[model samples]
Target chain A: MNKYIQDTHAHVLIWLEEAANMIRESFTEQLIIETKSNFSDLVTNMDKSVQNFFIQKIMEYYPTHQILGEESAEQFKDTNREHVWVIDPIDGTANFVKQQDHFCILISYYENDIGKLGYIYDVMNKNLYYAIENAGVFLNNSKLPTPPAISLQEGLVSIDVRNWYGKASLERLATEAFDIRYFGCGGIDSIHVITGKFAAFAASIAGPWDIAAQRIFAKELGLCVSKFDGSDVNYLKGGNWVISNKAAYEDLLTIVKEF
Target chain B: MNKYIQDTHAHVLIWLEEAANMIRESFTEQLIIETKSNFSDLVTNMDKSVQNFFIQKIMEYYPTHQILGEESAEQFKDTNREHVWVIDPIDGTANFVKQQDHFCILISYYENDIGKLGYIYDVMNKNLYYAIENAGVFLNNSKLPTPPAISLQEGLVSIDVRNWYGKASLERLATEAFDIRYFGCGGIDSIHVITGKFAAFAASIAGPWDIAAQRIFAKELGLCVSKFDGSDVNYLKGGNWVISNKAAYEDLLTIVKEF
Candidate 1:
């Protein structure tokens, strides 16, 4: 690891801890919430505040670095850059507003187009899952081995429940996978895949911020991250994506692609 | 509360804590796993061991009590008894085998055909939700207020993911509720509705032990517990069931009952 990257990792951890504290404190205070795109798609006051916090820190240190965030303060056009940061301050805002838990914060750093550092902070659970390219993934200082290859028949999968309502996605997985579960939060649900607890996660719709951190971390752990059709993911242009164990990826793609 | 009932509550809580410890210990060791009715329906060695432990304690402490357990060694048929206990040592066996979390221990006690005391212990989360007949429902030591009546359009719901493999149950809720989620564990999913986090839970298939504890606890919290067909639940006979909040029940029934 480069000296600069090492220092940056420490700084990011410090910032994440501070962000987690802000979320905890927000729970005791009243939040201002509004919907985006649709009723189920929600954003809370903390989402905007947290996103602003990250942008402020990034601008102060790496002033010219490109950034793509959920609540972007100053939008930067997609470009090949030496340093780029992707952030989703609150990945599952609906869970944050209704359940007050299960949501997570996602942060990823790409240096010269290579995914260098990725962090998925499960705030309520106090879990920090991160990956540093080939250096391997860690769940809060504990090194997590690349998960074993699991097949659809023997594994459980998490699917965005709303996507299953149309019958096609639900029926395809119902016959192949052992069962399905929904945590309704991308970062939290994807952690199950990272730890080998679940074989895959298929979300029909998502934004760049939603799948950005997951893509970077999944690459380090030997997990497959691709569009629903098994094509390479364009991190800057997120759509339907499937993150799965090596063996389970093909099975998930076959089903999720149909939707 | 009578002296006998109060003492029984204390004894039950004490035994539950011990059972939780036993579960934690088993997770550190290899558990013998086997299928029950089919491939997805599983029963671990710990499930049987836990059930046996509870039965033994109950028999020794209250020999005259009639009991119905998932893994019953001594058959105690349904009889007119002053005390009857229903136990599902490990409610979500598939989850216990796969995720090692989300599973729970369920126990319900009835006196002379009337539900008296009920306990749903989420073993992994260490949340013990209980109800004492007319007494208020509680999670750990904190009393939970009766959840407000939430309408279908404004509430979240849970459905056994397997149940949605077919289009009937899926579309019934897809168009009505705000959204849907699946935890793959009945006890864990019901906890969401118990706390007003979710409006309802609909499972197409379940056994007596799967819902006995929820039935007792839901009654006290003023939540509706019934069959999917809007008929009364036969707690001793395994069948489909719906447990919902007061206002959400009618809307759910209007759709679910059709299936």
Candidate 2:
């Protein structure tokens, strides 16, 4: 049993390293940029290329792992596989095209419906955040210390403005926080929450590929991750989610629930 | 007259460079960050440091030249001065404090009530944009070419959302653009418009110092610089201003007037 777990994590790490290399090369090539739903929904050819690279690498090693990726996933498909790999090749496509630096590659691995490993790589900064459940999170070889518990009034939260305008949960959360920031990137926002750069991050409509990896690392860092209704996150479902430092989590959940 | 113009530009350049150096040094030293009215109203001790840096430099080198700055300027008590220097020491304070690096240093020179030279320094990138009226604008050392004319529906416009929410003119302008972006820096927005990175930029409230330098540069690049109502910009007063590529300027004003 011990050998199986170690082998799985080691294989995932090798794939992650290869993915990171592909990302770095594509970024330097000045990839073609395009729009998705609106001008704000920026997508680049690099996104697809990176996803293809990872999908190929995963197939070569873990052929049976069910693959779900942001650029290729169909919304309604049901893949209830015991081992699934979810990926967001380029999480901040807008920032990737415009700023060329504030984006990341995210990967989550689940085994027997339990999160086995999570990885988020900030491509430009060359910082990699990863964790295995019950094992501590690490930021590029250094184990990240658990952030100090902070309340809403003392913490800054990263929120997507679209969610704020569409739902009452965001406005309620805003009134209780010290400040709110929006950088238009899910992976970066998730990193901020776990690293203490933000007290919490609340967003709606994020996919499983988007939050699954970060959620695992955030949990290992002693944060509370939940759906808007204060329920455990279902890795197969995509919906509203909030991750916060422990002290602010209950209060945030209460405000979100009232909405 | 040519010698006088050269002398004036040279003097302003030296002083501006000195001020820029001070800004870079203070930022590297890790200045304290603070907020003004709200979290959005970001300010830092470095703002005052840079402002004072320019103010002292201006007085020391050109004592006869009038000085105006965001932090130190009162109402234009001497509006008819033959020579006036307008400065915004550190633009985009919020981005700077947030470690986002999109801020700039701005300075403008006017002689006998006419713009003589305009300089906007993008500090993070270390690129300086400047123009002498009738002499043409330049990004760093290269002369800037005029951008292709585009209409409101075909171009990106930069705006300050805070200003749009507060002003009727801006609200109307906001609804007429293909897309809008808010980076919270007057000088940065103006330079982007002048360089065609953004087709137009409209903000309801900016001091003369904020627009003085960029206005001359935009005009040299075939951009229209005026108040929202298509009236001339009065450097002695603070009001709404729009800088745009020619076609966009005309098309936008028509839409804005209807609003």
Candidate 3:
């Protein structure tokens, strides 16, 4: 019944919220900061702790549900699975280490490889953004309205700082926008896009755990989410993604195509 | 007596705080956005409102004190008065208009043509940074300790956003530092420099009202505040100013000397 599905979703949402809180508390303590591929690339012990928290919670609730997370599943190399839970324990490790308050915990539940429910929690603000497919998105238990359709020229855009320096695709978009901000957190950026604070967000590199929850919530809010080439986002792959209100997304694509 | 001067400073501080509250409330109602020179050159109704509020308070308490403010001081071009009060009612007008929270209220009082007191209120955080010359600095009544000396290589640098894209001096410093931030407020930038949150701050176009109080406070804390060319700062003109801890300031000037 519809009631059963809703109840199940609510239960999972509560569990995820609790898990996120655990991660945030651990983050408040010292984090074991570690460099990834380069000086700019960073990961932390809190990332693993949060991921394990979610993984353990899922194992206890639904043993059959597969789990994928940034820290533990980086070795998996593939994520095409049914009834899977995708997680990014800490989405902005760089910002976290720097004591910047723009990071968040992101999680998405997939049924047969299709996103069924999504959740993104901004820990600093203590706001949770969540959505079920075909149901409306909610921010901190309040239903969120669809963002107004704003244009590239009239709206603020969020650009990845890495892209602004030299990435041609990002630079091209930057030139066409009124203003750009780099808050150093992907989930926080997507939340702004969905809330109309930012008209669009473009990032050249992100993993499944980074965009999955925001992608589902954004779509439910009548926003567009896609790869840079205007293709459907492959949630399992590390690739460029752009999310925006309808008009601005198309305008951004036009510039991206020209580039 | 010291008590009389202290009482006068306290009285002005309380009045300014009230005016700041009024400005914040009015700004929240509606921004009334406008431009100064170009699209990037921004101003707002809140700027004038805050200025008027302070001017009225100054007139009511001490009509003999000459007032100079960013939004309403075009008529008073000469700042040679014996008891001139320089004010930037809202120091970060762009940030205010854009609904960003890093703006401040800057007030500098001169007695007999000599700097007497300066107060910079970070409105959003409610942290009031103030100093009377030779009396040391305080953040909301607690005396602030002198920040430790740090070099540009290991420190975070705060720069004006305009300098980032337009000049070789900023670009060179940006390349040498670990990171750079542009919070879009001169008073806040200078405060951060004095507090050790930033190793250095350099802006090319800040008026006397913006740096007068902060410069005195920085000097009292054993930090350096001077023109970029290592000359004494003239408070009557808008020009390049660099504030930093001792080691960083000397190192930055050495680099500027080459250019």
Tell me the DockQ of each model, to 2 decimals: 0.71, 0.12, 0.23
Could you tell me the TM-score of candidate 1?
0.97
Q: Which portions of model 1 show Cα errors greater than 4 Å?
A: none
Runs off by more than 4 Å, candidate 3: A1-30, A77-80, A166-176, A254-259, B27-30, B79-81, B100-102, B110-120, B124-163, B166-176, B187-210, B220-235, B240-259
TM-score of each: 0.97, 0.75, 0.82
Q: Residues A1-259, candidate 2, lDDT per residue (tens digit)?
A: 2676678778767777777787777755867877777655667888898888888877887877788888888732455667788889999776665455667889988786777789888887788888878878888879998987878776766665433433455556555666555555788887877877677887766888878897788767878888989988887677888889898888888877764
**How big is the positional error of residue A51 in model 3, measured in Å on the Cα after superposition?**
2.6
List per-prediction Cα lDDT, in the order shown.
Answer: 0.86, 0.74, 0.74
Candidate 1 residue-wise lDDT, B1-259, digit = tens:
7888889999999999999999988988999998877788888889988998999999999998988898872486776657888899998888888888889999988888678888999998899999888887999979999998887877889988776666675786876788888888888898899998889988889888888889887888899999978888987776889889999999998878777
- Candidate 2 chain B lowest-lDDT run of ten: B162-171
Off by over 4 Å in 2: A1-44, A75-82, A94-103, A112-159, A162-181, A188-202, A220-225, A229-235, A242-259, B1-43, B98-102, B122-159, B162-181, B188-204, B242-259
* Model 2: TM-score, first chain: 0.90
Best by DockQ: 1
lDDT per residue (tens digit) for residues A135-228 in model 1? 8899999999888888888889998877667657788788789899889899999999999889999888888777878887788888999998
How many angstroms is the interface RMSD of candidate 1? 1.3
Interface RMSD of 2: 5.6
Candidate 2 docks at the CAPRI level of incorrect
